[model samples]
Target: MPVRQLADAVERVAPRDRRVWEGRLPVAGAGGIAVKVSPVRARQLWMVVGMWDRAVRSERLRGRRIRSAAALFGRSVLEVFWDLAQAGELRALEPGPGRERALPTATLRIVRDCLGIMAGLVKPADGAVRLPSVEQPEPKATVRAEVLGEVYRGLVDLAGAGPLERDGTALSYEDRTRLLAMVCVVLDAAPRSGELAALRLGDLTAGERAVGLRRRQQKAPPNRAEEIAALAEVRPSSVRAVLWGRRHQVSEAVYQRIAAARAELEPLPEVEWYALRPGTQVALRRWLAVRERLVEPIQGGRSALWVTLVPTKAGPPGVTLRPQGLTQAFARGMTALNWVMAGQYGWEPMPTRMEQLRRAITVSPVPAEVVGK
Candidate 1:
């Protein structure tokens, strides 16, 4: 039946519920006329209206101090229903003469949400009502361990090599810089991706003892401080030191020569840096060098630590790297590392690089001087 005729039928039989279905048709016919709604659509609409009416009446019957149950239902249950519909889980039943259709996914979701909402609203003495939700299955422990191991190995490689050449293609100066900065930040501060993305050049204050990171926490309290020790054993040609050394210059001939030389040399075996060690300092220095050269530091306005080197016709020179972009970059680096590792050594079911590193660290004895102290 046409929507107008259905509206009329609903008005005659359930005038109070007419407004519930008003202007809610998903589609309209030609000339902006109300289209004929499926029998399933009509049924679902009426069922919701009926449910709403019952909820309202129940609130009055209970004489609760709070607002009407219908109001609560609209706020919670109705919203959940719309969410399910938008997710494409709600579909109209097939038009048939006499066929019992299974309950739609939307209907089930609505019912589930409504029951949970109503359970809280209704008195416990009313009945033995229980709301059961299936827990989502977690990823396998081995799989999770493997992923973390890959990420750990990738980070170590990045720290050592500064953005590596993948498939005979070297990353742009800007990309290499960004990856270097990300790895250094992660190693030194262990900040969330958002926090890392939020960092600015000004936020990094170099004191006599350490390089301090002063940034507002995205998920926690404001004004957290993280430090990279000044005396920390970093590579002399560290990314941090390089960045600091060539802060003003657009291009550094020395750094480029060094980078080129490193690229030509045999790749170093990936090594883990413990605490405030040489590896961390080297990564930090290298990252700083690249960031200084590539990123145009604009004070106050879009002064993000990581910015885009290339600008489009629509935008400015320094575009801040968003958290999402940072995450994608990290994932890409991990994938590249994994691919390289796979090529070098076939899947032979050996302990992860991380596990091996841990074993090595465990077996190594402390220095006599440090132990005595």
Candidate 2:
């Protein structure tokens, strides 16, 4: 369906709130209470609805087609979403050579969210579709202790070897240093890819023995008006008290309790600090020296600790490294290590998963000290 048509369908069913049509989609939350969502979510809702609208042939239903989200309440909207998934429309289509792919867990989730909200709008008690259980992704395979030892040794050897000029290929020495530092950190501290990517120059404090990591908040806290709106629905008495207290004095004890509640609701920092092993610290320092020469300080006086070692279409070298970049670097480094091992030691290729690397470190009897806490 055209975007305009989907927008029209959404507008027809959406509440009178201007924001709902303009930017947000109001979907029912846990108890069928409405929660606002981004326009991207709104698009997903209509995508499923459009499939339904096109499939329905009954003149009465087809003419009125999804006139309201309530039209989807007890309907086969979930089935439609699944059908699309099976057809390789909802997500990538990578069926086996002879067989169709099974419905993905992620598509299952999308169906549940889209249809569930529609159900909630009509039936508060049963707001969403009761979906079949989704299969969880299998955990990364653990590298054997001997294999891990060899892999670590290979990486250390490669890092110390500096840039390779084999096959007349020009490799970035800075990138190799960065990947070594990242692998060392991952083996010792096991920070999430995002945390590692977001590390800044200032995050490495205490002489780089310890690193502080702050995870940016993904969801914004409710604004004052939103809080009041929620209180009106869930805690009417408290809302009333707050409203009354604005014009009149409340007891000191009551005031203190309210203050405590407000403080408890306030967002807390998502910051963490991890102690680095001596080896990990040394790797980081080496990378920092390479980074300092490759990247000059801008007017802001500081930048991301890890940066692109090579130019990209987006820009020249020195752009801040994202989580994807870190993953790619690890993959490339592992591939190079495999080539070296295969040529020299005649060993089979080892697992190159970063998750498995971290897991291997975690499950070892004498695991590398990756965390202080």
Q: TM per model?
A: 0.39, 0.62
Q: State candidate 2's TM-score.
A: 0.62
Q: 1-373 in candidate 2: lDDT tens per residue?
A: 3323434545545534655465545554422234675555666666655545544433334443454444444445445545555455543335678765555566666755565454544544534344434566777677765665577677778887757655544446776788788987776656667777888987776567877766433322234324643533434344344432221234445445544454456454465566777877888999988887667643321478888877776455677887787887887787777767786663558665676776666511121244332
Candidate 2 positional error at 342, Å: 2.2
Clashing pairs in 2: 116-128, 120-127, 188-370
Error of 2 at 233 (Å): 29
lDDT of every predicted structure (CA atoms) = 0.43, 0.59
Q: What tens-digit string does per-residue lDDT give for candidate 1 at 1-373?
A: 1223333444433334456545433332221223443444456445544544443344232343335332333344445434443343343334365644444444565555434423333324233333334234442233232343444455566445545576665555456546655654454445556556666655443421123343322111211101111222233334233332221122355445434443454432222112334544555566666655544454422556676555634255466766666676666554555555664542323232222222222212223233231
For model 2, the stretches where C-alpha displacement exceeds 4 angstroms are 1-64, 73-75, 90-126, 165-170, 215-269, 297-301, 343-348, 363-373
Q: List residue ranges in candidate 1 displaced over 4 A.
A: 1-170, 207-276, 297-302, 312-317, 345-373
Candidate number of the best lDDT: 2
**RMSD to truth, every model:** 22.8, 10.8
